[model samples]
Target: MAVIENVHERVLSAPAPAVGRLIDRLGSDGDPLWPSPTWVPMRFDRPLGAGAVGGHGPVRYRVTAYEPGRRVEFTFDPKIGLRGTHTFELLERGPESCLLRHRLVATPVGAMRLLWPALIRSCHDTVLEHLLDNAERVVTGTVSRPVRYPLRARLAVAVESVRLRAVPVPEQAALLHAALPRPDLADAFSVRVPPGVSADPQAWADGIFRNPPPVVAALLRLRNALVTPLGIERGDSSAFDTVARTDREVLLGVDAAHLDFRADVLVEPDEDGTTVTLSTHATVRSRAGRAYLAVVRLFHPPVVKAMLRRAARVAVAPPGPGARPEVAVAHG
Candidate 1:
């Protein structure tokens, strides 16, 4: 049997007990570990202890040993292609310093050897680094060094960028009404404006889609190039229809590009400024929807950032003739 071993460790600027407490809660519900933006966070069926069943993403495993605040070990299910034990341990180096470590010892049988080194290893390295940084933030007030994406993860992101540009525009919305929660995967953006500025939610939506920011215009050009060749027609601002409205909330429905999206524009007035939250809920119902979304997730943050930046511009820019009256003065 060929055995594969891997280990990652970091020295935290906090005491062992502090590090232990964070480790104990790793995969349990309410786990505080910040997940890698590119992958699913770990989840456990129960608290860390012997016989607990849980894993991250598609991997499944069971706890083989446990020591609260000290160490815990997980043995992967053979079905996952790796027969091995992975353990998390904390060691006190000083009264106020501790070493946090993850050690995995496994035997790769069948096709796992290829999968482990190529896909699994890259994902594991990136996620583990993030996990350690999260622990450091918990122990210390801040992380001295933030997590940096490895080469492989960066390449994955580049591939995602190209795919986003190539996505086709759907002619109509998918009729599937099964709405999922705001989705842990959503990217959100917000802007604050002084209460005196009264921007009409409808007007804001109209401007947002009608005159897109430069970043968005570039994306649209890419989409147009791809769709034009396929003979698929493009949609305009008319595609964003106001479906629901209230004094404080406006929901604009969108049907475009293989996705059904609801843009929720919420305004909460305050003494200092009115806080605006622009949240977009999206769903894709194709047979490859899951895979499509995974790729989309990598690109979601940039989309939100561009939209919010543009909306802020719209709110603050002075009205020209019939220009949407400058209603909200944006604050960073």
Candidate 2:
């Protein structure tokens, strides 16, 4: 038995699972031309049943029913503010294409429902378009280009091993600090923190003693060479994605183990030149993952400062688009 039923689905040339995930994830941000109200770093909460907020701070309910890479239903609750669910499902047609359906049903408190459905719909479509465009780009090989390499680093990988010398300290830190969100690390994809918890240090201290400590974040650093021999971009996370066995480790940031990580590269132009930083962090299970960051607390100020400087040096690279700047260690 269905209440208010509205059906909307799109069929793509892409596989069903892929279309489902891409569509479901694009909820408030599916339309390419419009800005998504649920951008990852800024807006949008997963687990549709999760409550969202209005501009000021009114609770919204979202209930998501999804089957990965298939279909998604995002239902918004009016009792709360912009509450809704996002679901995804994939139906394999043959070997190539699939059907993708994404729905958003909102229960607007009495009158507000009529106020903003169109605006919400616009944002949703934009994100969906972006997903298709990105998928096309990848399939067409317009993305995933190789990095610019130095004759030395390039030759060493393509030919022989190059001797390692000094560690580039200042350069690595700057790169990490830029890639990693130093100030708002806790603001990442967060689980609903019950009705009474908070983001304060004192609250955190009390939380640990009184109840269970939710996963905060795992802080870490990594370094590697991506010479032709390694067939990788220097310190690229793509380098590890091809691994066969995924390591199993508890989320407490204690023991170091093998992991699959991606490095986000962000370049900022300055009066001097350009600064590039690689965003690196732990990708443990969401629950245990938060505990994994406990290890970062061990770093002293001097150590932290040193790391930042190293990343900075890496971030501020040399001039010239074709030129491969001096090789420096890339830290997380």
Candidate 3:
């Protein structure tokens, strides 16, 4: 039964009307504010107005108030034990400048009472500051100082990415569907592409092949050693040929004496967020392939999942200083 009130405000060197326009676009396809890709994007069921129902990630709420260019407020759903309202307010300071503010006034209940100060507040503070940074960048075309994600925030993001699950090879995975029309073995795992991160299949593929986990690298070495004695081909990036590719998907595989295998890396975007799916399809061509598959199948799922999770973590990571000028622009 503790009430928490937090506020973050920024004075942008822009007119209230211009800043208000950005606020109006929150949760839309081309949102100019609200940091994303590094964090989940804010979304609403219909649009940004009173009665619009949505919130980013696990926090759920409905729009309790709205003012196109001046303000908007979201009241938390009681089921989650957060009873309060978070809002965005715009105040005109001058014809050429305005103050943008985000305030959170809520009471945490049950476990949230403990978790709020320990965890949620820090993450919330970082996100709100980044949101203000984005507003400055979108309107002023630059941010005087961009907020960098702290270690704890990075760890929180990593923990959340672990929850991503295996799903059916989606129809949008055209390359996978075409390459493995009928295959003896098939599986797919997906992770949401953070907003602002590159959705290029090549980028995601590089994540998988560039620097795999030590365990995965060790497994690959063992696989190569065991297969070499059987006169089977050793797998590596060089061994895989690019069978097909498009903006959304890349198909890479090798046709070995014992088996034919293909890996499809796909990027699909929907209302929720962009998803990167990694799918494997293989067909045994010889008796040796069957025996090899039996052993490999046991470890394949986890290996793929780990690789995807690693790539996602890398993609969403905040860029180190001097890494690239565009990094902040994208996140902002």
Candidate 4:
């Protein structure tokens, strides 16, 4: 086993007690220092104190010691094989200043020994630095220099976004359920909306339709070309009409000679974060419709997955001055 120790410290222009208060609220509902919405949040079964169990993301640990506004320590779960402890401490430097520090002492066993230096360490270092930046921003009203996510960290987040799952259409999608009482096909795919993104389903739907990826755009063009010959309507933004909408869900679809299709976009909020589900329903009206459905069924999953993933990425990104205008959804 190889032991790896890492430490990060920052001097805040605030009193030790004030800085320590932030530590006490590490996993609380309105945490001002954990750098969430961009990364997995810190959470515990109860609250922040000795014996409280929780961890961020895939890392699991239990609080072993707590000193309220001074220091807190966590011991890793043995099953993870990264045997060690990590802690946060506040040291008073002066009447109006303090030093905040975080340290990780772990011995990686088996495969983690190799994985640590290559991947985990970079992500760990980045997260900690961002935490410190958050502390500076909250206590001092600004960060001297905010930490930009490196390529590796951005890549890690992108890869993690791809881990979506198929799900039954949510109850919130009442509009879709009513529209397709017994459709020829019904399927849903869901992904967690990253922390800090808009909870409006319209925002998520715009991400899916307004600026689709190149591959998805090409596929749609080919689809339109193939279907136009058979008198089927093209699936484009202009063809879609918002049939029904609420704050949490929006239903959009198009009708054609061969079939009727609708998509339900629903945003559900939970403790972890918001989850955006895209549920699609289709009703075939003829033999040509059935043949089209057969071919589409094969490509539906991947296309929907790609579209949802792109929406998630767009939803989390910081908007610029020239950001695209949001797509409008009709009321009622």
Model 4 regions lying over 4 Å from their true place: 159-162, 193-197, 286-288, 316-332
The lDDT of each candidate is: 0.63, 0.32, 0.81, 0.81
Better of 1 and 4 by TM-score: 4
Which order, best to worst by TM-score? 4, 3, 1, 2
What TM-score against the true fold does each predicted structure earn? 0.54, 0.30, 0.83, 0.85
Best model per TM-score:
4
Q: Mark the regions of model 3 whose C-alpha exceeds 4 Å error after superposition.
A: 159-163, 168-184, 193-203, 246-248, 319-332
Instruction: Give Cα distance to truth, residue 273, candidate 3, Å.
Output: 2.2
Better of 2 and 3 by TM-score: 3
**Stronger candidate by lDDT (2 vs 4):** 4
Off by over 4 Å in 2: 1-9, 17-64, 77-86, 135-332
Across 1-332, the per-residue lDDT of candidate 1 in tens digits comes to 46888898999888899888887887754465534222344667776789989787568999999999999899999998988898899899999999999998999888888887886687677667767767776667566666676677555433321121111111111221223343333434566543334556665555555566787778767755655654444545555678777666667766545556666666666543455666666776553445555665776667755666565544543223222222343222
List, residue by residue over 1-332, the lDDT tens digit for candidate 2.
Answer: 12223334445566655454444443333322111111221124443223432111232334345444444444554454444454445567776766554454444444445434534333344434433334444333332322233443333222211111222223333323333333212211101111111223222212221221122111222323212233322332233222111121101111123222322222333321233222334443343334433443354223333333333322222212323222232111
Better of 1 and 2 by TM-score: 1
Q: Which scores higher on TM-score, 2 or 4?
A: 4
- Residues 241-317, candidate 4: write the lDDT tens digits: 67889988888887777888999999888767888899999999888999999999999889988888877765554
> What pairs collide in candidate 3?
37-194, 37-195
